[model samples]
Target: MTWRLFRFFLFQLAGASLGRFLFRGSSPTQGAILGLLAASALWVLIDLRRGARLLLWLKRGETAVPARVDGLWGEVADRTWRLIRAREQKAADSEARLQEFLAAIQASPNGVILLDKNNRIEWCNETAAVHFGFDPKKDVMQHVGNLLRDPHFAGYLAGDDFLHEIVIIGPRSTASRPVRLAVHLHRYGEGRKLLLSRDVTALEQAETMRRDFVANVSHEIRTPLTVLTGFVETLQTLPLDDEERARYLALMARQAERMQTLVNDLLTLSRLEGSPPPGSSEWVSVRALLTLCEQEGRALSVLLTDGSGKKHDLRVEDAADEEIAGSQAELLSAMSNLLNNAVRYTPAGGRIEVRWQTLPDGRAEFSVKDSGPGIAPGHIPRLTERFYRVDSSRSRETGGTGLGLAIVKHVTQRHGAELRIESQPGQGSRFSIVFPAGRVRPLQPV
Candidate 1:
């Protein structure tokens, strides 16, 4: 400011000096005054020109400092340019962060969506698109209620209460392959909302299975317990001869044995589920496994025939010189279950064949094929479910605990094997377990 003031005064003095030199012969005072006025006008004109140039730079959207715009105008240009650059950098950082947030949401297993003030979808992740059967690109600005159309969800959104989540059938759900989703919404930004969804089909199915298991176990145990109670009462209240007493005792013992078998099967299933997968360390001879299966099948056949003189035509095919890796007890248990099931279900004089063969790919297959009252196609898939039965009364009459195939399934899985079941209404069933190559090997020479 001092320099500008000094410069202004200096220009006036220089103008006065020039005027005096040129007009010394005329009025020197008037000439000096006139020179000062002329100098001030020129200075003002130059200042206005610099201000105009800075204004032009701004109007052109240029960020660079304007050239020849010194004094106050120059400082203004530099500061304005720096502020513009800083804002641009800030905007770039915000955009990058937004993209990263969207990418994270897209990768999430759960779905996420953003809605505007009017409940229209502003943005949604890919998972959200799948959950709602929406095309993210085309669904923008579409109303949330219009897309979902679930009455529960519509009411939840319409109401002010968003404190809880709701479960709804997914848009792509079907009768057999049902899909379920848990959804919740949160109020954010002013009148806007954030929606979250997760697939809960597996969880719901597990819960359903748990309920069914509890009910089945209670009913199974109650039937035998009721019979035992009734027999105990009769024995305590009635006067019977030795023969009648002995017969009643035998019947009581049979019910007790049935209860005991059911308990043992339940325990086996629990152990299989709790225990880790069997390792491929201990080896059992394939011949030994086949012998054990044959023994179990024949014993069951005899028991089921009960001196009827019409025994099952049971056959055990010769086994190859191979060894199976893992727990021998578990392997025999699984093999026994399949063979016993075949024997118990096959009618008198029906054919039952057990085979153990190594495939060309080095995997070993242990199969039990029975000419029983063949299972229906629908029941074949769920035959391994605990306590599942095609004919509950028939199973009880045959002394089956209804957990045989479930045990087989668990053991097969633990040993890294696959269980396959094939059956039609009239055709007999074939249950097979194919052990992985890693668990099957050629028997070593003695």
Candidate 2:
């Protein structure tokens, strides 16, 4: 400030000298007045030039700090530069945060979409793009309704009701591998909206399975219970001969046994689902398992033949002396189920071969091959489903509760084994459980 004052006074002095020289014959008072006027005009002009430079620098939006100027103009330029730098840094931080937030949304399993006031898509996560079958780049600014043509979703968007979520088949859904989505919209930010979608196909299928399981169990138990009740009533109300009584008692016992088998299978399945997977610490001998299966299989085959002198060509070939790791009871149950299924399904006098062999890959395979009527291709995939049967009547005649394959499947999965089924209609069926090398090892000497 002092320097500015000094320079201003010096300019005035110079202007007075010049005025004196120019007006040498004029009066001193008039010359001094003109000199002061000249100095004031020169000061104004210098200030204007600095202001013009400051204005030009601002217009250019240059990041470089302005050079020092005199008086209030220097202070004004410095303050302006500081404000601009702060604003730029704030804008950069905001951009970085926005990118971080978008990245988090992209990694989410569920779909998220941002829509403008006009219902056009502003942004969407990768999951949303996949769910809606959209190109993330190309689909921006496109109307949501125009891209998703589902009538249900269109109606949902049009309606004012947003309290409840609507289920819709996603754009990528197909008949075989259907994709179900639960979608809802939340109004936000002045008429704009957030669209949230989650894949619910697995949940829907599980619910359907639960319903079917309950219905099937009720039917299975009720049928046998009804028969047993009828038999009991007959024995109590009517005077029956000894032979009739014995036959009725026998039939009732069979029904009771059938129900017991069904209950036991249901328990096994529950336990398999609830318990941790079987580990490799406990091992069961393959030879022992086959021995038990052979005894049960022969008995079941004899019972199915009903003493008509019909017998199966039952063969047990144990080429692998490996020990399978798991619960002994579970292993036995799984192997027995496969063997029993073979005996039940194979016609009398058909060939049935049970083999335990070690593959070249060090995996041990327990296989049951039967020359009975092979399952159709369509039925093979669903054979392991609970209570699913190719011929329900035939299965009943064979005294099967229809839970054998399901139990086998659960046991194999628990033991880290793969259940492979090969069958062609009218040819034969081969059911194999291949145990991983980690679970199978050469038998240790006792």
Candidate 3:
């Protein structure tokens, strides 16, 4: 720039000398006047050049501009370039930091999504895509409401309230497997919003189990305690005969047994929770498990007389080729529970059938079918839940702790097996534990 200014001044000086030599005739005053005009013109040219350089830099991109110029113009141009470079460097650094932060968030387990002012998806992490059943690339710029059309979520976005989140059940969730998501949205930066999602099915189920467990424990204890209280009051206050006293004592004993059974079930559940999955070292035979069930059914039948005072027939179907790899005690407990349930529910002279068979795919199934009043379709799904009962009065009469199916379910899970229930209201129920191929073994007949 300085060079440019100097060049301009030199051109002005040459013009001034030429004019003085041609028209001034050695007049010093005239020479000085022309020189001043030339100098003013030079300054104007320099100013113009500086303005042009600034415009050129803007048009040509920052890197195209030269680092230095001649004279005073060079000083101004260099200062301007430094200022522009500083601003750009700061911007680049800020952008890099922002990108790093976003990358970190993208890798998080919890889902993260950003929405524009129009509520369209601007950016979303891979986790968010999986949670929402979305293709990240495809779903960008799509409206959040359009993509997630759950009524609760729609209402959440539409209403003024912004405090709570919504739980959305995935389309793929089923009885065998469940997928649950909790989604929340928060507004920021004018009208833009941030959405987060988490897989909360396990947590939700745990909370529900805790509540049900408390309720079940209270109900179970209260029933026995109420009976004990009544019997104690009867013995203490009423002047009863010797037979009456014996009858009341027997009733108290039965209640005590019921409470004891409930406590045992609770302990079994705790053990299942704390213990690791069963190892393959313990091989339990199918015949042995069925035989145990048969014995238990017979014993329970003696004590259990139906409304008509007749005993039910307990039959164990022999499958010679099937054995299971699991703890004998756990296998016995599971088989016993199913058999007991069948016996307790079946009416007088009703037949209870226990069958074991191997599937074509190498899986083994132990099925208990009874000729009794079957469960409703709705109750079938929740039969494995601890303390769930179809008929509380009947369950109590049968001396059931209501944890039979729950125990069976946990045992099956530990053995990596599946529990399937098929029932009709009047056709009786079929409860089966479908063992995985790994746990099932073939028995060699002698």
Q: Highest TM-score among the candidates is held by which one?
A: 2
Residue-wise C-alpha lDDT for candidate 1, range 24-141, written one tens digit per residue: 7888887777777777787788879888998888888876433458776777877877888898889999999999988998999999999999999999999999999999999999
My TM-score estimates for the predictions, one after another, are 0.87, 0.90, 0.70
lDDT of 2 by residue, 1-446 (tens): 78878988888998887777677786776787788789889988999988888888888878666646666688889888888889899999999999999899999999999999999999999899989998889999999999999999999999999999999998888887999999999999999999999999999999999999999999999999999999999999999999999999999999999999889989989998899987788988888889998999999998998776789999999666778889998899999999999998898999999999888998888999999999999898899998999999998878888888999999998888999999998999999999898998888998
lDDT of each: 0.90, 0.91, 0.85
Instruction: Name the lDDT of candidate 1.
Output: 0.90
Q: Which residue pairs collide in model 2, if any?
A: none
Q: How do all the candidates rank in terms of lDDT, highest first?
A: 2, 1, 3
**Model 3 reaches what TM-score against the true structure?**
0.70
**Worst 10 contiguous positions by lDDT, candidate 1:** 63-72
What are the per-model numbers of colliding residue pairs? 0, 0, 10
lDDT (10s digit) by residue, model 3, range 1-446? 57665777777777676656655667856875676686677777877787677667657776545544555656777787878888889999999999999899988999999999999999999998888788889889999888887887888888877788888876457877898988888989999999999999899889988998999899899989998999999999999999999999999999999999999999998898799998997777788778878888899888787356677877787777567899998889998999899988988789888888888998888899999999899888788888889998999998998898889989989999898899999999898998888887776454
Quick one: best lDDT, which candidate?
Answer: 2
Show model 1 residue runs off by greater than 4 Å.
Answer: 1-71
Q: How accurate is candidate 3 locally (lDDT)?
A: 0.85
Model 1 TM-score is 0.87
